[model samples]
Target: MQDEAFFDETEQLEEASSAPTDTAARKRAWRLRINYRFIVQHTPYILFLSGLALVYIANIHYTEKKIWDINRLDKEIRELKWDYISRKSDLMYNSKMSEVSDKVSGQGLKPLNTPPQKIEVEKK
Candidate 1:
């Protein structure tokens, strides 16, 4: 009789524990279904907004690169202009008619001994 009671008590305990496990499984399944439904409902909007953000970021990066290129070109242009002006000044300071004549002679062009007389034409 004592052994029969012990067996009955063990079976009751096992049934009680398995009942809670089944309840927990049902709760977890319900939560998963809710999460899936929420994601399915909002997926399109989420994807669209992500695409727009990516495009905006790409445009900003391209504009930044272009601005940097323009700044670099401006600096280079200023340096070239400065070099040109300095060289022009040096040429103006050093150039002379006699030196030009010497350079012309070196290039095989003979210098005229006398200035040519000018002729003026009147327009009617």
Candidate 2:
């Protein structure tokens, strides 16, 4: 008897839904409706997830900035190292004995022409 009643209700519902206008009406009723209570209940969790996403994005940007900075510093260091080597080589060339003599020639300084004479003196 209970099953007959249930089946009767289902038959009526199916018959009502079979009409095109009824189906459209049912579709309209089934349209999504916002549940504000659900949103309010899970607001914190949603905010936390949003925050996590922002932090993840920020971390990637920070890492990329650090990488760029490191690469720039490396390039600068290499340039400075090359400059240092060039200046050191220039200094070494300028300090050679032959180079020193040539530079001092303009100042009336001359290189030794002969070996130094060692003089011996009698002790008093």
Candidate 3:
């Protein structure tokens, strides 16, 4: 009986020493699992924010290009409008009916000496 009790006490001491190692291993595993879960839960949000930032940068670039294009087109349209207005004024000033008639007369056209006879139309 004395030998058996000594053997049992040795076994209990061995188990006590090993207990802390098992507990430490279990705690390490639990920590790893929690870290993995944290990474998994937030990974998609991180990727989504990164994608949104890239899209916002691209949109800013596109809008800046469009604004420059609009400004260039507006300047071109103003230049064209000014050219059109100047040309229209020149045409109106240079091409008078009296001058046209004088040119026609110079090309052997004579004015009518008599008045034209009037015709009446009846509408039903």
The candidate maximizing lDDT is 3
Tens digits of per-residue lDDT, candidate 2, 1-124, equal 9999999999998887787898787766655333565577789999999999999999999999999999999999999999999999999999999999999999999889998999999999
Clashes of each: 0, 0, 0
lDDT for each residue of candidate 1 in 42-70, tens digit (9 for 90 to 100): 89988999999999999999999999999
Q: List the residue pairs that clash in candidate 1.
A: none
Instruction: Give the C-alpha miss distance for residue 6 in model 1, angstroms.
Output: 48
Candidate 2 or 1, higher TM-score: 2
Error of 3 at 51 (Å): 0.5
Q: Against the unseen true structure, what C-alpha lDDT does each candidate score?
A: 0.91, 0.90, 0.91
Error of 3 at 93 (Å): 1.0
Off by over 4 Å in 3: 1-41, 97-124
Q: Clashing residue pairs, candidate 3? A: none
lDDT of 3 by residue, 22-109 (tens): 9999999989887998679889998999999999999999999999999999999999999999999988876887666676887898
Tell me the TM-score of model 1: 0.52
- Runs of candidate 1 exceeding 4 Å displacement: 1-34, 97-124
Worst 10 residues of 3 by lDDT: 94-103
Ranked by lDDT from best down, the candidates are: 3, 1, 2
TM-score per candidate, chains pooled? 0.52, 0.66, 0.49
Q: Model 1, residue 41: displacement in angstroms?
A: 1.1
